[model samples]
Target: MEHRVVYLDCYDGITAPLLLGALFDIGLDLNALKKAMAALSLPAHTITSQKQDAPVSGRSARLALDAPEKAVPWRLADTPALLPPGTLKELVRQPVLSMVKHIAQTTSKLQKLPIEDVSLPDITTLLWLIALTLGLDMLNVDENYVSPLPMATGSRQGPHGWEPLLLPEALEMLIRVEAVWYSTPDNKQVSLEGAAFLSELASFEPVNFSVTQVGYGCVPGKSASDGGQSLRLCLGNLSPSSRRAPQPAPSPVQTTLEQAESETDWVTVLETNIDNMSGELLGGLLDHLLELGALDVSYTPMQMKKNRPATLIRVIAPPELGEQLAMSLLRETTTLGVRFQHMQRLKARREPRTIQTSFGPMLVKVKYLGEQLISASPEYEECARVARERNIPLADVYEVARSEVQTLIIGSRKKT
Candidate 1:
């Protein structure tokens, strides 16, 4: 099944209520959302949605929380404790849980605090609600894709020179999601937080995606100057051939045609020399960079000055992420300088295909180059996982996948 792509346009800025409001506007059943909230034992809240013309022509949702007349600020550590037994396990699936954990760990590291120390009740609650609404399936999101612009950092003035306070929780949410941050015209302090939140969520600028629907949410007493005081949530579908699209049946003729028209693009290569960092740290760094969207990362042994043994770290990434990734390298590694170059790479048309094996279903990467089958390999990670679970040799699983792919390819060729 194709994963759904949802975009949050915080043109006005993001708040907990605004996030919920947007989800509600986007066809999330109000009863379902309320049930999820109740499962979490959250405070009573009412949702109101209506069509509005200020920001754009769309429906908007608003959430009103019923709080005590005098409520004390809650500690971030205690937020998760409020959830009912098995609530998180039931509501948040593995994929969404992975993302949530990433956010918590990253925030904890960035803030120089324990994971439990990072807390914002409203943000945490809203995230759970959003997760429950969206379910646990992984979105077809690129690992290395970063927003072209950064989120707004400073406060902006209003008609009366009133500066809006940016919400730390909002900013943290954007960073955790790895969304781009940017400043929009007609900026106001009131919208800064939401703007930052939305900017990051809605940051897929160059990709060709179509917004199938739009949802809006509003926060009372937090209106932007343009009267579009609501958060716009856009649910988009990636263009055909998106990685997130379902794998089509293997077709050698179609694969040949695509390979014939395959295009080459310039890819950036970044290298840095390091001697001080430990091998364990380098390994971890490689994993981090790959997760951040590096096309490839490697380390080569070389001799530095004074006959000292060192490792030369190399990273290949798309041109769009060259600078950002380069900056990350400097920040994450002990290297002070980096050398980079761009070179053309010819990529074969490829897609993933699943084959039934004695052990289980295994995925194989089928590659084609201009009407000719170039390569086919079992996805190592999948094979490894199946091997461990089945208590069998990894080579047996690999051979099964390879034999099946070979049979398919040969049969397709004979048919053509």
Candidate 2:
């Protein structure tokens, strides 16, 4: 089955108002947001989000502040209080708290100040944080992917006059997550509140996923020339792939228990996101990666930038094959770059055992934790063939095979 994913293109950078606008633009319910945010007990306020195309493309999200920055600015530690206790839905509570902690810690580490000194975002941003968190849950969002930071250039009019392009807190978040950022004379700075929350929720996505729709987040008060002024959200589904037939040539790296366990220290992960390839093309690419000696190759559906459906291809292999596999990705896919990471890996000792079953003979992979039994799984191909020949339910073959394997293993252990 395929699942939904949203990709936020933060080329222009984000602020609380900007995030609100984007959410509103991307089909976030304006009225629902107002009702949800009203719980803050903030001074009288009304939010207006219109799907306007000018000033910025897509739709515009406007937080009309009926009150000034309010006396006694709320600090990061006080964020929990800003939204009344028990006001948040249980599903979003932990994630929202996690966002708050990420923001505070990011601010503290970068500014050389205590977390308590880090101030809470203004009313608009605060409200948007809650809305976005709740929205992610409501959308049943399985994952979020964020682009690299775009360096802020020059200065912007701030409450205290001209200030650095991107807010300090936002910059801290960019640095902490090690987000790859680019700066040009034409870059736009991100907002303090926008940066922290967006950074926290993002997980890496590989290339070549599928996108189904798009929503735009238009920043108010900024034009295209301002740089990084708008946000584009690409929505898509990631399909779970069917299992592959066994490969015989080089066999497989994990053919034996020892090789699988010993690979712990040498495994490297290679990934890339691709949007321009078709399903037929991907099959060829998968075979190519495996021929390069990949222990496993998998594809996940993902939304790529610029309203494109893409695939995130992941390859697991020993370190020795890293260079070759990476070369294969670049040579075969539309991706401009590839990402590599070393991973700690372990596998239970498993071996094929021939077991008697009502259908006839069956092959099962018996696994162990040291000397103790773990599980015995009937091979898919074997079970599938049994189902086909006898015209029985596939489930029946699986259940009967599992039961016999268990009985046989237990009897042998007792005799020992």
* Model 1: colliding residue pairs: 10-198, 13-194, 13-195, 14-194, 144-293, 150-181, 151-181, 164-189
* Model 1 Cα lDDT, one tens digit per residue, 1-416: 23256665555655545555666666666665556556656566665566555554455555555653433443444534554336654223322333344445555766788887665435434444343344211233222122233344556564547533454444555554455556655443323233333332334444435677776766444346534466666667653345332458859976665648765666789888998999999999999999989999999999997899999999999877886888788778876456565555667778888877666677888887766666778899998998899898999878887787788788767876
TM-score of each: 0.46, 0.57
List runs of model 2 lying over 4 Å from the truth: 40-43, 69-71, 110-112, 155-163, 220-222, 226-228, 242-365, 368-416
Instruction: Give the 10-residue window scoring lowest on summed lDDT in candidate 2.
Output: 238-247
Highest-TM-score candidate: 2
| Tens digit of per-residue lDDT, candidate 2, span 84-190 | 54777644654566567777787687678988888754655555567778767666765677777678678878887987877777777666567767786665657
Q: Model 1: runs farther than 4 Å from truth? A: 1-3, 51-57, 70-72, 88-165, 168-178, 188-205, 218-223, 226-228, 242-416
Candidate 1's TM-score: 0.46
Candidate 1 local Cα displacement, residue 297, angstroms: 16
